[model samples]
Target: MKNIRNFCIIAHIDHGKSTLADRLLEFTKTVQVTGGQMLDNMDLEKERGITIKSHAIQMEHEYKGEKYVLNLIDTPGHVDFSYEVSRSIAACEGALLIVDATQGVQAQTISNLYMAIDHDLEIIPIVNKCDMDSAMPEEVEDEIIDLLGCERSEIIRASGKTGLGVEEILSAVIERVPHPVGDEEAPLQALIFDSVYNTFRGVIAYFKIVNGVLRSGDEVKFFNTGKEYEADEIGVLKMDLSPRKELRTGDVGYIISGIKTSKEVKVGDTITHIDRPCSKAISGFEEVKPMVFAGVYPIDASDFEDLRSSLEKLQLNDASLTFQPESSLALGFGFRCGFLGLLHMEIIQERLDREFDMDVITTVPNVSYRIYDKQGGMTEVHNPGGMPEPTLIERIEEPFISASIITDTSFIGPIMTLCLGKRGELEKQNYISGNRVEIQFKMPLGEIVIDFYDKLKSISKGYASFDYHQDSYRPSKLVKLDILLNGESVDALSTLTHVDNAYDMGRRMCEKLKELIPRQQFDIAIQAAIGAKIIARETIKAVRKDVTAKCYGGDISRKRKLLEKQKKGKKRMKQIGNVEVPQKAFLAVLKLD
Candidate 1:
């Protein structure tokens, strides 16, 4: 245990966490590096140039003729994947806080740092991207010192691309980070940090042994589910799973028990021997709080059960995802899914399509609200359709977030303008260093759920980094805006909005739907309404045929007769015509800029 070092890498997005990880792997000769971002194995991750999952691998390094075992977990840097970072942090004793030389310390950097500090993990500050011409190593080093209160000599200046200071980082890990401490004689207690599903191998759970030893074929039980199974195989994580006879205390490894159901193995649950179980489960695991809610329905209604199974398997891989059965009048039966953010929601949708071959329609995303009635009965509503009638409601409270944005001084004005437009209140601003500012704001989570991140990125030319956490809920003047098609309300199209911008937003949504909804044989009336009042309306004209053209050169009365006949046909069609809303129309509500 003294020679074992378990640590993870945490940083802001695109700040060289994966690149530095690759350098570390190469330096330790863990794997043959043929390309960059070797740990980001997902194709979507490669396409987006972002890490979506936390990857763990074991490596061996020889220092001064003494062999050492290093367990390195590379975590995603995006704010949406902060839960992944938290899980990785929990399983490690230390973290490498990587900061980009050009970008300095951004919002996510500060947030992730705070999480590490909260976990009491030893932080080793490292400045990456030192080879770039625009790199500001000195300024970034000073910023790191201010953020972490670490000495200049302790901070390592390195370039992930050039492989500089890789050896020093390894040496620091061996010298600075404390070895994992636990008792091998105690009852077996392993904390399962992550797991994955397999068709041939059943479920594979990756865990860190906190106490005692886990051997192959041992009878193990999950603490949360209280389900027991024999360990089919036990191994340590390398580029691949390397079989081990036994994993003792302070060892991170994987165990397969031929567990067919995903529910049997829960992330953050404790694993213990059936004969001599641990007295208590491991604590300090925080539950995931979803920031956005949307309905995910199958494109074909009959595929509902398949969608449910697909989501179940997907949830096993992404424990942060939460869902329950829900039905929509407009979209039929589906699940109301909770996601960390818009990007996380999009990625899940894409994954469902690519991985499970499940074609799904995702409704407009919204945040959950607390609805209080006149009788003082309170209900939590995640979907607009689930909201009670206006007459029965007394007040509605929406979730708010404390958002922190780090950007250049030049872009502060536009960033503030954007936030203020979203009904955000400026809390305070501080100068992180010369010309770099950190702006704080208190904004409704609903305001930033859709396009705020994209807008911030575009306005700042990708120079700004943003991070946020949920704050207390506040009572607000909110109204439910319903979209109607020919006097019929579509439950899926309804949304809760602040009264101040409801009218304008309703108008924009009606116009946007007018462009997205395909033209029917009869006119389609798209109206945005608040209760009995129609606040905005747009008409999608019918696809009319030239009925009068057949009577060309006819008398005016004859043309009028033919037009009158067509008009009667259209009126009949309108009465029975069901508007088939294209899938794009449902998604268009998100882009109402």
Candidate 2:
């Protein structure tokens, strides 16, 4: 057990954590050839150049004739998966904090640093991407030392691309990262950090053994569900499966039970032997809940089943992805899906298209609102279509977020402008490094969850990075803005916005919808309103013609008759005309700023 070292790599996106993992695998000879960021084996991951899911693998390395077991866990670098990072840290004894040498500490890097600290894990700071032409190892090293108050000599510099400091990194794991401690003779207890649904093995729970030992014949029970299943198989992941009869304490591996679904074995659940169950379940097991909600509908109503099947397959791997059958009068059969954030929502939508081959349309993402009624009744509404009437609602509470932003000195002005416009409350501002600034703000989740990231990138010219976590709900004056076409409300076009900007947003939405909606045969009314009161309106005129055709020398009577006939035709068309709204029109409202 002293030779076993369990640790994970934490970093901001594109910091070469996966590359470093590949090098570790190569140096340790875990595989014949180098993995080359092969830890990111998902098709979508390779295409997008980002780690979406956290992965774990076991490796064996020897130094001075002593064999060491290094179980390295790779985590997603994006802030959208902070919950995953927390789970990964809980399953290990230490973390390798990777920061880019060129970019220094980013928004997510600081956030991840705090997570590793909160877990009380031994942190090994390593400056990655040292081979880059723009590498500033000294500047980044100073940043790390200042942030963590560690010795300047303690920070390690390495290049994942060139394999520099690879051996030292391995040695650090053996010498610095503490050996995991657990009682092998006690009750079998394992912390499940992740899980997957396998066709042959059913639910394969990826766990780190915390106490006792797990054998193939043992019947295990989930602490949260209180359900028991036989351990059909047990193995460790090293590129591929390495089956074993037993997984002792301090080992990280998978337990194959007949459990067929991902929900059968949750990510943060503890599993123990049925006969010798632990008196108490492992601590630090947190249930990940979704924060962002959006309505996902099949482009073709007939493909709803396919969409559902696709989402199920995805949910098997992604425990945080949630969905329930939702009926939309405007969009037909669909599901109300909950995601961690915008990137998560994006990945799921992309997966449905690539992995499931289902074309789907997603409504504008929204945060859950706490609705209070006149009679003291309270409710939560995620979809604007489900909001209670304005008169019935006494108050509304919107979700707020504590946000952090890191940017170069050159872009501070624009970054602040964009943030304040989003109803942000400045909390703190300071220079983290010589030319880099970190800003903290408290903002309404509704404001930034939509296009705040995009706007920030545009203003900073892609030099700024952002990360935010959900905070406590704050009371706010909110209104549901509805779009009307010829006096009929479009359910999908309904959205919730702060009442202060409702008039301006409504006017802009009305204008954008008018520009996108094709001209109809008759005059169409495009109105944005709150309840029955129209806040903004635009009129789309019908196609008109001179009707007095080939009038060589038209007299007053002839022209008057032609005009009267044209007016009558316009009236007839208005009575029977039904404006055909294009799909793009509904989508245009999403981009209406």
Candidate 3:
């Protein structure tokens, strides 16, 4: 039996995880298997610079006269998909903890590293991107050893971009990482880590053999659903070549069963021989929960079905994503989508626009809010449409988050002040890596929903790294502010906020909103208020006139045609009672100062 090596690559966002994967594929000559280069097919992934879904690759190498198959799993870096990362780790025996030489370790690095350790994976730390001018390999190495408790010798200095120390890193994988052990004679069992779609081949599930060898044409049943199917093809994902058949124990490969839909395959689902199935499915697979919610609507209402189909296709590959159809009284038809976090939402939107060619309009992201009704019934509302009436709601609790900020010592005071202004409570502060300081605080998720990163970047000069997770919701005196244009409330501008800052925030936001929106032919009044209490107001002047000045008899038809077009265009504009609202009005409310 050949030795088996199963490992995952874990790193912070933009820490060169996918770049290193591409380099390894090039190094092992696996790029030729998929025509020219397989990694090039990851177009959507390349644009984002982060992996939204987990993928596996198998490479063969001979170390010290022993041939071995190395299964490498790439995981998502965004916190929203941390559940996927955990599942990938569960299927692997070790991990290659990649750290950027210049950026060192950030918030995500700490979270993902802890996940790897929780899985009891042997970690082989590597410092990547040493070829860059700002690379600080020695300092980062010291941080890894001191903060992460990684061994000094096991930390390999490599440049995935330049292909330096690639061979030595591979050697370390063979030498330091333990091999997966499988009972070949026992009942066949494998753990599905991920799956993909093909036009001709159907649904192919990528998995690792946990015990016994799985052969082609074997009848297997999924442990989660108890559905049985015949494994028609068993093949490995060759680096640069077509899939080669006959993947054995401890090997990472895709199995094409008769099942054709991604819904049939799930992460952590155990596949076992039907005749002699295992006693129980592998444990430790946790259901991924969404932390942020938003409404996704197509720019063109006619493309609603297209948006739904694209979301379904995305969901097939990503088990962590969740969505449900929703309709707003004012926004029309849309889907209430659940995401891992803000970054996940952006990635999904980008993929929808870039990959599926769909233009989407997304509402501001919101955390789940608790509503205590007057009759004592409590319910959680993730969408504004689901919120109950103010009279029925006794109290509203907003979700708070515990955030950590790592920055230079100089900007610590400013960051703290910014956080405090945003209703953040100081937790603790400390110094790490000798010079860098780490600050922790608890803040309202609502405050950080929009432009938090941009503000932090501006204040810290782009040197601070931030991380936050949902802290428990707390009781607060809050109000649901309704913004009105003319005499009607603009549904899109409605948001939950504290009563104290309602007027100032409302006036500032209305002005910004007015700047974003185009003027109509009539005057519009932008007013912010809590129920009957007026907080702030602004005026959006209307266009003086839209009529054609010269209307000659020869151009009467042309003038009529022009007027007809204008009338038709104005028909698409939202009319709040007697007021004519421009098409840009909906988007304008989303803008924050």
Candidate 4:
């Protein structure tokens, strides 16, 4: 335990967290350094240049002829995956706070720093990307000092691309970061930080030993599920799973117990020996709160059961995803899935196609609302279909968030305009340094669910960083907007919006849908409505085949007769025609910009 150092890397998006991790691994010679970002093993992560999942690996480093075991967990830097960062911080005693030299302290850097401070983890600040020609090491060093309140000499300037100061970082981890403290004589207690599923091997749970020792072939039970199983295989996480006879206290490792169902193993649950269990389970683990809600339906109705099982397996890998069975009149049987953010939802949709070979349709995303009836009964509504009638409702309250945005001084005017258009109120603004400013706003969560982040980036020319947290709910005048195709309402196309912007939003949605939905044999009327009143409408003209071509040289009456017969046939087809809403139409609401 004295030689073990367990720590994680935390930073904002594209701030060299993964790159710095690769350099650390190369210096330790833990694995062959044939490629960049060896920790990000997922193909989706590599293609997108983002870390979607947190990866854990063990490394051996020697300092002054003394060997040390370093357990490093590389975490995603996006705001959508902050839960990953929190879980990694819980299992370690320290963190490496990496900041880019060109881009000074940003929003996620401050948010992650506060999370580490709450857990009482020792923070070793580093100024990364110092080798770039455009690097502002002096100014960034000042910003780090302002944020962390640490001396200038404590911050190390390193470049992940050039491997500069890699040795110094390893030395800091050995000297500054504290080793894990646990008793080997106590009962077995290990915290499961993360897990993954295997078709051949069942569920593999990665955990950190907090007390006692866990040996192979021992009977253990999950604290949350209370299911017992024999440990078939136990090993530590290197590049691959390295089998071990036993794992003692302060060690990070994985256990395979032949558990077939993913539900049997839960993240943040404790694992203990069935005979001599701990008196209590581990605490300080909070359930994740999903901010965005959307319905995910299979392309084929018979695939509903298959989709459910696939989601169950996916949930084991991503604990932040939550879902419940639901049915839609337009989309048939589906599940109302909750996601951390828009990007998280997109990644899940792609994974369902790539990993599980499931073609699914996702509806427009929205935030949960608190609806109160006239009799003083309150119910939480996640979808527009769940909302009660307006006559029976007393008032509706929507979720709000306190958003922090950091950007250059030049983009403040445009950003404020964009936020105000969404009914955001300016709370406070502080100047971090010479020209970098942090603006705080109190905005409704529903306003930013779709394209707010994208617009912010474009408006700031990719210099703005945004972060937000849930705040108190406030009463507002909100109405449910429904989309109708050929006079029939589609429940999956309904949404809740503020009354102030409802008219404009309805018009935009109608126009966008008209462009996406294909033209059929009969005219299609796309209408957006609130109750019985139609606020906006568009028509998609029919694809016509000339019935009068055969009467080209005939008399005028013959040509008229042919046209009349064609019109009657078209009228009949319009009555029985069913318009199929394409998958792109369902996602059109997201690109309403």
Candidate 5:
């Protein structure tokens, strides 16, 4: 049997997971052999400094006369992609738990480590970014030993950015990480951990061989569903940067089983021999669900088709992205999309802009809300634009989330006050990694799912980290504050707010909406209303009269033309009876900025 080592790199966001993968790719001679360039091939990946999706690559390296095929998976760091990270961990026998040398252990690091431990994978702790001026290897090593209970000397210090300790880290993988120990001659069983598309060859299903040899042209069945297909091509990932034929048991390879689309190959599905099919599939595969929702609309209506095509291609690569067509009275046509979290949202948006080159209008993000009615009917609404009438909602509750914030002790007070201000209920407080403190709070899921991360970073000067999960549905006296331009509801100005803050929030919304819309041909009334009550009001002054009653010397036809122009301009005014609305009124209500 070939010596195989499967491992993943885990770290908090911006902690250098991709950089480490690049170094490993270089050291194993995979880049030289395959002629693959640096890892950040996608413009978005390089620009963002984060890995939005989990990616795996293979390398063949000889250590101490032992030839080992190292399968390394680089995982996403944000909490939104935690499910993906967990799956990557499960696909491996060990993981390099990367902790930033200068920043020490962040909350995401701890969360990902726990996930790795839960998967029963061996942990090879690695301290990265040792080249940073603030890096304190001794303190960081001590913290890792104390917090994670790992041997002090076992933590390998490396600068992934500088290619330091790359060879040593690979050697340690051979010594510390266990080789795959499953039988190769038993019923052919393989676990499909990831899948992608090859433009000319169709879907390339990546799987780890568990039992029995799988050669090209063999018939295989997905054990979970008993679906069968003949292998069109079977291959290992070559340094040439693509799949090469003839993969066998115990090796990580791709199966081009005439699976034309990636949709047929799911992560965690078991590929087995048709004649001697395995009796069981791999355990511990969880379906990833999205937690954030937003409305995505094209800047131009003609690009709607382009948007759909782009989304489809993106979904082919990322299974977690979800979307559905939605239209609003304000936004003519758009989509209500669900994502794993904020990072996922940003990634998708960035892809749309960068890859597709499509300009889009995005709505303020909202979490899934639970609607309770007196008639015993219940429903979940992910977009505010989809909310039912107030009369239909006898009682409404929004999802609450449990959030953990890690920061230095000095910022605790400011952070606490901000949380309290946002209606977060304190759960507990504790110290982690010595001087760093973690504060747990129960917050309205909607509050933290939006710009909370950016605001937290701004408040903490980029020193704080936050992560959250849905807790439960809690009763909330909430109202949809709608702003009216003229007499019609300006759909873009609507916001879901607690009843207590309706007046103040409405005023702020109306003021902002007024600023966004341009001065109209006529004066207009911009008012925020809660049922029959007007909570706040603003005005858009009307354009001055264009034509005056005057006698023309010898230009009677010119005067008539001027009068016709004035009439047309008056009709262009957004008016509700005596009120005239400006062009800016509509735009102002739609965007908070």
Candidate 6:
């Protein structure tokens, strides 16, 4: 145990975390780099150049003639997966804080650093990507020292892309990171940090042995779920599965029982000996809670079962994913799915299409609104269609977030203008090393969920990094903006917006729908309304036909008679013809600018 070191890397996206992981794996000879590059196994992650899931691997190395065991946990760098980072940190004893030398310290850099500190883990700062021509390693080192209060010599300079200083990083881990401390003779207690589903093994839980020994024949039970299963197998990760007869304390590995589904084994669950159960479950284990909610439906009603199966398969891989059955009069059967953030929602949608080969329509994303009625009752409404009637809603409350953006000083003015446009209130600003700045704001989640990130990137010219967390729910003047086609409300196109922007949002949506919705035989009047009052309207002009074009030199009265008859027929058809709204039309509205 004295020679074992457990650690994880923390960084913002594009800071070379995965590249560093690959270099470490190759340096230790734990796994071949397949050309000295890719460490991410998932095709999507490779294509996008980002890590969506946290991965753990056991590596063996020899430093100073002393054999060492290194457990490296590679976590997602995006802010959307910060919760996964937190869980990974809880299972380790130290963190490798990686900063992009060119970008200096970013918003997610500070956010992840705070999380590491909250866990009280030892941090080793590393300045990565030193090979870039734009690298500013000294400024970054100063930022790290300022934030961490560590000595200047404590910082390590490295480059994951060129494999520079890779040996030094490994040596630092062995020399600095403390070995895992636990009692191997104690009763079995383990943490289910993550899990995956397989047809052959059912549920395979990835765990770190906190105390006691778990063997192949041992019967184990989960403390939270209170279900027991025999340990069919145990093994550690070395880029691939390598079965072991037993897993001792301070070891990290995978366990397979008779279980076959994700529902049986949950992440953050505690596993212990069934007969010799520990006094109580491990502390700091909590189920993932969702922050964003949206309705998802199949384009075809018959695909409902297929969609259900696909969601179940996805839930097997993602413990934070939540869903339940829902029905809509307009969209038919669907599910109300909850996600940790907008990125998670998008990734799930893409996976459904790419992995499951299913075409699904997602409704407008919205945050849960707290509805307080005159009867002194409170209710949480996730969907606009599920909101109470306007008459009964005394006050509506929306979720807010405390967001931080780190960027160069030159772009601060434009970024602040964009944030204020989204109803953000500036709280504070701090100057970091050189011309970099960190600006904080309080803003509604509804605004941020739509296009805040995109706008921020555009205004900053891609120089800024952002991170946010749910702050609180506060009362707001809110209203539901409903879209009506031909004077009929379309439930799928309804959205909740702040009352102040209702007029302009209604106008923009009405005009956008007018452009998207195809013109029918009859004139279609697209109107945006709040309750029973219409705020904006647009007309798709009726298809016109030359009723008198065929009239050559005939009497003018004859042409008039024909035109009169055609007009009467058109009025009759307009009364009977029903406009067919397409699913793409609804999608266009949700994706409106």
How much is the lDDT of residue 222 in candidate 4? 93
How would you encode candidate 5's per-residue C-alpha lDDT over 1-593 as one tens digit per residue?
54888888898888888888888988877774242225545677666676767877788899878788898888988767787787778778889999889877776787888788888888988999999999998888987897678888899999977889898899988889888778866888888877766668777777888778887888888877567899887777653345455566667778886666445666788998788888788788877767777788887788887887677667766778888888777666878888876778767887888877987776666777788887979988766666788887888888888998988788898899889978999999998766789899999977666656666777776667777767889989988877777768756446687888788778877787666666766667788998777989989776676474664476678888887887676666444344323434433343342
| lDDT, candidate 3, 300-365, per-residue tens | 788888888788777767777889988765667889998876667777887788778998777766
What's the TM for model 5?
0.86
Whole-model Cα lDDT of every candidate shown, in order: 0.91, 0.85, 0.77, 0.92, 0.77, 0.85
Tens digit of per-residue lDDT, candidate 6, span 11-116? 9888989999899998888877886335577778887888988899999999989998899999998767777888898899899999999987776777788888
The local lDDT score (0 to 100) that residue 213 gets in candidate 6 is: 90
Top-down TM-score ranking: 4, 1, 6, 2, 5, 3
State every prediction's TM-score relative to the real structure: 0.93, 0.87, 0.85, 0.95, 0.86, 0.90
Candidate 4 vs candidate 5, lDDT winner: 4
Q: In angstroms, give how far residue 102 of model 4 lies from its true place.
A: 1.8
lDDT at residue 565 of model 1 (Cα atoms): 91
Q: Write the per-residue lDDT of candidate 2 for residues 153-195, one digit (tens) a residue.
A: 7788899889998998998888899999999998888988887
User: What TM-score number comes out for model 4?
Assistant: 0.95
Off by over 4 Å in 1: 400-420, 424-443, 455-473, 552-554
Which runs of model 5 end up more than 4 angstroms from their true locations?
A: 32-37, 223-226, 239-241, 298-309, 332-334, 356-360, 406-408, 460-467, 518-525, 539-568, 575-593
lDDT of 4 by residue, 1-593 (tens): 89999999999889999999999999899887888899998889989999999999999999999999999999898878888888888899889999999987766777788889998998999999999989999999988887788999889999999999999999999999999999999999999999999999999999999999999999999998999999999999999999999999999999998889988888999999999999999888889988889999999999999999999999999999999998888889999999988889999998999899999999999989999999999999988998888889999999999998988899999999999999999999999766889899999999998888878878986677787879999999999999999899988889999999889999999999999988998899999999999999999999999887776675799988988988998999999999988888887788887
